[model samples]
Target: MIKPSSYCNEDDGEFKKEWKNDSNSSSVNSSTLSLHIAAYENSSNSDMASTADTEGLKGKHSLAKKWKNAKHPFFGSSSVIQNSFEFTRQQENDKVSQSEIMQFKASQKLLNPNSSVNHQPGEKNMCLFTLLRCSDLVMQKQRNPEKKKHLLVKKLAKEGYNDIYSNEPTKFIYLGNAGFVCGVSPTYLQELFGKLDGFHKLHSFRHKSYAFVEFKTVEDGKRAYELYDFPAIEAAPKAILPKGLSVISEFITPEYEEELLGFLNENNEDMKNRSVLHFGHKFDYDSNSAFQKGLDIPPILDELIKSMQPHFGTHFPDQITVNRYRPGQSIPMHVDTHSAFEEPIISLSLQSSINLDYTHCANPTVNTEISLPRRSLLIMKGESRYCWRHGIRPRASDVGEDGELVPREERYSITFRKIRTKPCECPYIEYCDWNRNGVTAIPSNNESARQVEKTYVQQVYEDIAEHFSQTRHSKWNAVANFLDSLSKGSVVLDAGCGNGKYLSTKTDKFFMGFDTCHNLLRVANTKGEVMNGSLFEIPIRDSVCDAVICIAVIHHFSTVERRKAAIAEITRVLTSGGKALITVWSIDQKTDGQMSAYAKMRSNKEPTEMKQENNAKLMIHDGTDFSHCDMLVPWQRSSDGAQFFRYYHLFYKDELDALVESFDELTVIDSAYEQGNFIVIFQKK
Candidate 1:
């Protein structure tokens, strides 16, 4: 409970005159009254100095006047001021008696209109406790202004004052006695409030005993306010990880991580484009188990496993699976097949941190997310290994403990297990495949590739259509110049023309645009004649257009065959000798020691070099040099901090020319690197 003071500001001369008149008529002893007055006058100069530091000289004078003019209920006018001054003096000397303290408490109750305690009418109060407390708060304000504001807001809130305010729809709710000073941590608050609907973030003032919980909507805030039980929040534990599951952070050094990554890059060159690699035995995803044993584990990996044997005691792991994840890639929730592997599965994470979600097999609603930092080790056995299903959500970023977005980077994981000779006898029988006699097949290679495009490329563009359109308004100068060079009344096709930005580039030419995303087509429809269609199967007749432009579109295809088909479609719609301009994201984003515009948009922090492997389809962060030809790039929406990953098959120098040259009917007219993209102009024969 908080007791806030209310004081009236008045002129210094008038206040002094009123105080003098009231003091002469008071029944207090003359000696005691003189001592109190003298002590107050002595302390006033120092108190004013402290106030002047934060509020300036003018504010100090105003506060001084308010202190002198404040009235008391039981002791008549200005008597509370004298008693507060006396209380301050007594506190400094540490000589105040129990009876005097009791009288101060009674005065506080009388001053607080909201206090439930009843008091007799006309009871003589010897002190003004609120004024004394407010004076002390003023002293605290000089040291920390933010803390003072927090305390003041909390005090006002406790007294039933209206603190919620916003010009837009309200999404923030105030919580009293729910901050660091009240033994409530931000993580603790997040755990409690995050369970509610639409909860976004929690902001806690450490020095102030209060917090503001932000939700996704005003209704969410109102609902949370009604449902949240503040009294029980303090009693909850800090964290509750799954039983028999443990994470050891920084289990390996930076040097060791580099060494392990180097070994994987060198040995697994043939399978670099694939996300998963296996040694000792190949994992069969369809069956959710491992088979085809006798594959040799590299010498370095074997040494690493041997080093970890001390932690495992007697049971040593024999098989290893290495998984590489792009920013938005994810593994579906599952328990390792019981009959295929023994207990105590271990995994090591490298290069980036990620959240692993665990859910009870019996209850879908019971789930928790835990972070596995880079270079960490995770070991699972018993209930955690059998009864809990673990998985990672497909996202480019995760919400941090402090309620902020933490961007993701490329990550690598090494998992170790021993083949089981007998059936599993674990206590958790409900999830055991041995008891259930269940088997599942793996998806085909082509279907898996298509799924990547569907999730990372097609779905991403559709979700971020509005925001993407906003950022892509400016047309490229080269593209605009090419459109201007076209003959007047020439029929033109803008394949994959997102938002139809280039359709109106040449008003004299007849332009038609087409895109795969309906949301983008809707935006484009407002600009010019646009239709919803895919680049692979353009809805146009052969030789119908005089010119065709496929700007920044071909790279979205996951495979070289699909990219070739897109190029063929563009050629099929062009007339003889018709020109086409194609641009793809370039592997080299820097020229002559200067970074391109795309790289410049990234943070100024020093970029980390990615170790190269054979055509690896890795995740690439902005501003970093490309280590793989095919990669996933992240696009973050500013409005809600939602991140989407876009797949790109970047081209190296001479690669686009080589691709166009493969078609004898097409002749490359000009080629150059511009603005982090490879630009190639070709004409149909």
Candidate 2:
């Protein structure tokens, strides 16, 4: 009889070697068990199947009868009898594989025959049972190689297999036949596949027309294979063009385009580079405005406008600006000044094709790129003309939808517009230059304030979080000193804690920060505990924080009531006598004899005047002194050249003190002007 202790040896090599040596003995005490072990040991040899058919047929019959009556060692006695009988029936029906049957029989023989039949199996017996099940799964996988391995791993996990084996790295081969073709660059492949989860690295063999992608886990590789191994159904391109904008391709025949280009060539003074000619009005490129009237439109262009009258309906363009761009010349991204031009603006492209990009004025995420072929007419009106900035990038070649580079040549465009006789009254009030300067009162109610904050503050921060984080690495000395003064083991909260710059100042204290922008919170999460929440309604319980800090956050509120409520919420979360530090942009940038850092950073060049009357919000010019108490500050992203505007309500002297003093439960402890901010420290009563 085989010794149970020998079967339970920790080293699997010794146990298997002992079993193999014992199988060759003719004097083995358990003859029936020896036959099963020998059969399993030689199962991989081709001749073993024939040997079992010839010399082992009677033995197999006798063994099946014994297996039906014997108890299974792995499963407990309550179910082993039923399980063993069912397994014997499966063998007689040929439902189980020959190798699987041998493996099961060999494992059963290793158990001590003299032990109690109802005793529980040991850990080694359980391991043997797991091996038998795993071998059965391997046989099933070979029969159907396309079976998803993740499902097999999940089944194994349910059967008590080690979880580490399920997470082993898996290699996936992406055949080039599906959508992607051979000889496609690896850079392009990485761009397409790198977005999937668990992607480690990819190796391309262009000559063999396939690539190998190694995933961090088997499940990840199986998911990627299911998604990319087969030809995918093409999806319709999303509609990104702004409303009221349309492009007419091949708007004019080749002959008509030549006629229009002939007049422009004749009128073009400087042919080697960029040249411009304005008619009906002299366009001041610097001011983006039409000034004194200039020459009349050429007779050929006037005739073309007359022919195009039906498309314009009642708004006939009275001004024309003809621009000729040499091989690499292009226009900067800009919205035609709202005060300068009327609706239904049109541009006719001639000579060569070029690309035009449009970005929404308020939301940079809503954008599109267009290619204007030669002889195409680009029409803009309503939101497209008033709310989207259009420009052409300076490049010798343009990237097409397929990512191929299309070389460029000389191009000419004739822009036609009518000088504005009145302020724009379109529906896009937030983006309209006229409306921004008009007598639109400050948001009076909570709903109106929420709308203003949502579009100008919250949305802008979410879009510029990455670029904004790069510029905010330096913490203010006053704020850092306040954090350093905190007691050890104190619970601190940073409201509107953008990028969590101050969270790591003193690791001794428990720091938790929250922000309204998820993008900023994602960055903050790596530094400390951070959550997505609003300043107006902090999620923490009342009187939970020993100290609170609100930095340059209350100024984003559009109205006095909202700002005061934000302050109240901060105090509500503070413990009794707990101190809170708050800061806001001050209207008075210059204090005492020194200019604040904001004013010092202003460019030497003159800024365009955007002052408005009647308490209207002004558009703050880039790198300039503030001219209004409330304004829209512009932030342009460096990556895509998209601009987003954030709203700010600057605080005047003693303004923050009065706002904090209105709450009966708070007391102002200290106030000062640091940098360009109005800093105030207060305590909850």
Candidate 3:
């Protein structure tokens, strides 16, 4: 440390007077007293320069009187270093004159010699120890010390660094894949690291989870690396991944994932639209020859496209293939044909979390697996997309980041790609089959297409539970009033009580609800008892419920036989005199005008109409045959600048009544149209 030359003569006298008056000064060491004197001398000149009467005092009372009673800038009452800087504020709020100020100035001089220094108000004159002091506060929080310490222990344990408080300097640890689990707090880490010799500062990575324990000298890092390299207890999980593969944990929020799922569900039918090359012009795997007009990017997916602008740069993706996966379902191992799509393909996952297997196309033995969390966005480009044939194994569940085998839930992924019009211009020319030499591959059959549709029905609703729960907060007055009419102590059965929004209102009755989607049931179970069961085959026995209400569930069946079976099941569950209510979306609703307006906006024939409030119309679709009375309607959920969709079937007014009439065990009590739904009350005969 460098020594200072001089202090203001008047300041020394005042400091001495205050120091002698203090009773605690007797306990202070000689070194601390010397430091106080040095600090007062160095900062005295700067403080005196800022006074309002510097010139007046110098002319009248001379130098000694000018410095007397000017200000106790260094200390609050010239007692100790802690009371001055840490406890109380000095007269000059702008400048914090402390013992550390002398050392900071000396360090500055040593680093940059022969430099002129000026200490003024509102200037960047903060000492180096300011950060250290700030960090110390975290370790010594005033309130609820036990609770804070427990939280700190839990956080450190999650990162596999539970001994952080004890084994800090010896172990320079950084967290990986800290999606939900808390890690060592920044302030705590800083405080611990600041105690190390030759410590500079801590540096966090682009991803918030990762950080570096930086030191001023290379020797410190080497020593730390050697000591903590193979500790008895590992600090962080070992990441053994294939080359060019990465997992970004929690890339998107749960609410945002729900919105994306809702948007996709609403616009799912557009994937079958004529403009899309993949849908209209089928790929013949055998010949490897196909028209390259490319798939048309749907206008509904513009929000996702815009969100990906920062990554793709000038090249906007021209194709989006949304795939919904059910439990035990996985994609085959195959490279995205080089000529079909450009480099840097991105896939945004929503709903369920799963593991992806990446195997080298050339070297089949070289493969690795990466666990993907829900709402993670994966970017596959160059070697990862081309050289590797990435796929997922067929499994109902996968290991999570926490190392537990978690059961797989329904999942949806939106894969975005820039369609490559031309053929074969990659490093793996031998594997390039875009310009095929007469090699033929069989096309997918109709059964495969039906399987995909079946999966969509099961997976879409399951994946959007969290997001769908958010919107289902408002209970329909019509349904709530109907539940209110029921007598107290009546056992009520809600067939598809999503999130149990109405169950809360019927507290007087013992209400039990069930749905096919377990994820949705998870949300509903919080409010009331909910079971995982289908409408056609309810887990409950016959004549058990006092009343059964199957709301918006009858139309889900595509066939008349299945729809009739669902009605019979509900009737079977109710007593002879018990009342049952059923509701379904109606085709009688006049949404044709809105549908035409949406088609026009989608076609860009009338771009100005895009701003129109036709969200309901945009989602409804009428089947080609009105006689079948089977049409698909979509529900849109938008959140955080993204959208998702879920599909439902609407029933014609007469068709719903006819199905209910066919149930021989039930008699129609009342029928009415309320809130775009055909609601009918039936009494068990």
Candidate 4:
């Protein structure tokens, strides 16, 4: 039997042994490689998926007859599918092969003599009834076999299935192929599919309620589970099953559930005009689909997923969609009913924050809201994904109930689920009036359906995150390089300084600073206890200085001519032979380099009013087409206009090298992490 609790627990203890490096399930693409910063190694979120024994949940019923001898013993859920049914034992899977999985998954019926004779004799269903340990965690399995077993079930009338859905005593099977297959042990069935939701179909012996349905394709099987999850109308005539309820919800109507499937089906008016980044499908970070815990995934994130597996009964390692939303961006309403695991979807929010909106699928006007704080997790099972749709409302500013306007920003969301359809664009676009009359009726015929899906997809987003980065450190290399340029006791000068955060850290005692601003000097002096004069002119003995070290303070100079003059003065004050360590933004095409200084001119917001260091531009024309003036900020020398600067600089390698060599003999580090900037270890002669 598939016991989630047991599997989750096992994963918990084995994480140390397994989850140190759970690599991406596929090749590390660009997007995946970019977002991985090396600074978060110590942080751990203890909720990773592990083994748990959930067999004790309220009502206990006999499993499908084929799995009669199956007991709820679990090898684990995250790294492997741990259900056993002695089969033909072909050389199927060496290390949990898919061939072996297919062996048990394809078994369609129980020939056990103790079977209930209600089954239509000789009736065959191509279904696979293998009990999978419950979990929606990513990367739970250890092996990656090429081939495996498969399951099959008869396809019934969509309408007829709906009619008999609530009252029929459908036969559950452990079938494989044709008339040839292995029958599953019953206890195993109960452990996997939630203890049978006690509903019956027409002619079903009111005594044997609820049925477990498994499709040959794991993907198809999960979607079928969600669509036909027809909850039993308890008070109606076919109420032979245990009340349908999960740890997450009471009972919700099918109509209510469909309304919640907004993400799956988006045709609302308010959602039409939103300029969001993406619309559909599942995503997760892995080299492949193996859920082996200790492989590539960091330990901290693994635990957080483990804590929620028990509630996700059968499907192990749910297909998860990992998304990143920068400031001023969001995802519209959508349903997750198409997931491959038929199990519930669980979302874990990390880094930064956002306001999440949940609304009725049928009525977009009525909505529920929650401020998804950082480090929080939300789970939607049973009716949550089917009955109630969820989305993120775009907001430029968010005011708390406390009336304090808190600054809002970009964030990362880890949405976990089992994928149903292959990742693709939304097809219903062109003919539909989503942007026109808003969800107005569009013909629902097949040809139109194809076009509807085609035109609507603006684009399918592919994530390109970083794989790794340097760890954090406190000291600066520039400090050592600066001291190296000095003699036994020569006065060293720091110039063009915004502040003296670097004053006291210089190696020898000859360090002093010059700044264009004084308020900055006050803050710096307090931190370091010393201050010199301005950079325009120096009070020290001319030609008596040994060295200087300038940090990221050059790009902000009034202009290139003025910056050159500033560097000239530093040289004028230097001894006949001395050096300097200069670090400035140097542009590089190797990475997302700095924008041209002009991109800012086009982005400047016209100022309604201006403050001390901030300016409002006068680029607006007072005529026609618009009103109230779309505000704009000034064109600062450096800074990414929108996504917030990962690093700020408009440096081109050649441009920076010329600027430095223009004054003295300076050597720029050929490969600085910041392409827009570089470190120049200079020696003045």
Can you write out model 3's per-residue Cα lDDT over 324-424, one digit (the tens) per residue?
77687777666776777776778877788888877654334345677777878788866787667777877767655544457987788777777677665
lDDT tens digits, residues 1-685, model 1? 0111111121122222332343354553231222111001111244442332222111112333222211111111110121121111111112334365445434432222233333232211112111122233355545422223333333333322212221222345544445455554465455455546566655554344445555655567657644531121112132357889998889888998999988776655334333777888887877767877846887877677877787676887877899888787787777787779988889999898888988654333446778888999999988888867788877778654432347988899999988887887776543455633321111124565577678778899999999999988888877878888889999999999999998877778999999999999999998899988889899999998889888899888777777788889989999999999999988887665445677555422222221223233334333346656776676778678565667778888888888888998999998977888888999999
Q: Mark the 10 consecutive residues where model 2 has the least summed lDDT.
A: 80-89
lDDT of each: 0.61, 0.61, 0.50, 0.35
Local lDDT at 175 for model 4: 17
How many steric overlaps does candidate 3 have? 15
The collision pairs in model 2 are: none
**Per-residue alpha-carbon lDDT of candidate 2 for residues 599-666, written as tens digits (9 for 90 to 100):** 55442122322223435544443444566788876777978977677888988999999999999988
Candidate 4 lDDT trough over 10 residues, lowest sum: 34-43
Candidate with maximal TM-score: 2
Better of 1 and 3 by lDDT: 1
TM-score of 3: 0.33
Candidate closer to the true structure by TM-score (higher is better), 2 or 4? 2
Q: Write the per-residue lDDT of candidate 4 for residues 137-197, one digit (tens) a residue.
A: 2113422110111111111111011001111111222211111011223333333332223
- Give the TM-scores of the predictions, in the order they appear: 0.40, 0.44, 0.33, 0.31
The per-residue C-alpha lDDT of model 4 at residue 616 equals 20
What is residue 72's positional error in candidate 1, in angstroms?
Answer: 48
